[model samples]
Target: MNLDEKMLLLATCFLFLPYQIASVGIACILVQAFCRHKLVDAIKNQTGAIFLYSFIGLEFIVTILHSNWTGLGNTWLFVLVGLYGAYYRKSITKNTFEKMCDLVIILSIFAAIYGLYQFNQISIANGRTFLEFHIFNSPKRRITSTFMNANIYAMVIDFVCVMCMYRFVKNDNILCKIGYVIVALFNFFVLYLTGSRTALLPFVLIFPIFLYCVRWKKLFITSIVLELCVCGLVFLKPSLIPRMSDMSTFASRIKIWKTAFICISMYPLFGWGPQTYKKFYP
Candidate 1:
């Protein structure tokens, strides 16, 4: 891989680090600045890009006014990298995109394999079922993998599954197609290991869209099949839907969303400064 490819690969990997994605993103920004890269040129001609930066700039100003330094830095990393990507969006060739997708698929497969190891280790150490292996605040055991959180792992696997599905359908190379299938199957297992219902949303939503792209009629049929599969799983493994018996979490989430809306209403323009809600929310 070339320098740009290597940079993207490294950026993707570092993004998994706990509270480190922003720091690495800052380093990326510094590199771009030092290299005299036309960072502004990234979004100069795109109206949507300009609007994006406008919103981000407004948020930055609000954070500064509130003296929310952590929020400012946090927002800076994401917005800066987004704008930078917009600047260089056209530079990423199709070949580069494919290669990056391949790398991502491979990474997900490895992450799933490692998660298997972590899951087994936990089960062995506790001599108990995964249901009893406490993970964070969740009510059940969650395979956190190396991400340190099952929810994050679940979301990552779901995202990877989507990517792999895209390549799986689009690619003609037999070997690559096979690899995508293998990666996708493993992702489902790993996603289940995370015990996250969130994983179901992306697959259920994105798979139909993908099917629509490939064959419109297949979308409906495929969705029905998917729903049946989910029902079948639920029938076979009632434990999979742990939250079905517990509505406390569901209630709390609704309450939290209401509180978030209230907070947003209070700060219509800035919204209590970025990342400050956790500290300030009562």
Candidate 2:
């Protein structure tokens, strides 16, 4: 593999590590881009790059106007990472892309295992049964694994689950298919433990579309039966999915969305300066 590809793999590995180690991975990509003089080309070659930079520029102007300098760092970080993605997408070879996907699935399996362990530990510490443990009991109660939060962890797991499903349908190797199924099931359970209603809801809706697209009749029927069972379980014990059962959390999010809409209307261009949501949310 080339240096860029190797750095990309390194970044993927860093993604599952704790304590904002992913920033180091981002730094690696940025440094490699600088050394290779790929930064400008990365922006210029991509079709959407102009729009991305325009949005960033507008955000910067809004930040200056609002004097929300603290939010500027996040905007810059987002732009840098986005640029790296654009560059990598254009430059990555087919072999490298396949390798990256395989690496992501492998890492996701390990992450899911760690998250399950974290959940078990938390449940034991709380002296509650696994099913009885509420994710929102505290910030630390949810199975974050190596990511910053349960939602992020759930998002990654959701992506990996879809990848696994795709590979399972497409690959001819029996052993590889078995591995994919195992990983998908493991990660799906971990996703459930995450208590990320947003991620779970979308996955539920998208998985059927994937199965339909792949034209897997038997697997699709099996999936339907499994989903029916899951629905039955949820019906019996709504607390299994806390976010669905808890109306208060949903109401809180609704209020936040309403406030965000108001804030957007007030600004109408750019934004309330990145991380200023808390200031205006109330």
Most accurate candidate by lDDT: 2
What is candidate 1's local distance difference test score? 0.70
What is the C-alpha lDDT profile of model 2 across 1-282, one tens digit per residue?
A: 778788777777877887356776677677777778876676677877778888888888878888888788777777767777777776688777667778999999778888878988888888867676556534578899889899899898888888787777667999999999898888888887888887887766677778877887787777778888988998999877766766766677799899989888987866667788878873
- Write down the lDDT of every candidate, Cα atoms only: 0.70, 0.79
- Provide the RMSD of all predictions against the true structure, rounded to 1 decimal: 3.5, 2.6
The TM-score of candidate 2 is 0.87
**Backbone clash tally (model 2):** 0
User: Model 1 Cα displacement at 157 (Å)?
Assistant: 1.4
Clashing pairs in 2: none
**94 Cα displacement, candidate 2 (Å):** 2.3
- Please provide, for model 1 over 198-278, each residue's C-alpha lDDT reduced to its tens digit, 9 standing for 90 to 100: 666677668777777787676668687978898799878865663444555787888788878877888876674678777
Candidate 1 stretches with Cα past 4 Å from truth are 19-22, 33-36, 121-141, 146-148, 216-223, 232-242
RMSD of 2: 2.6
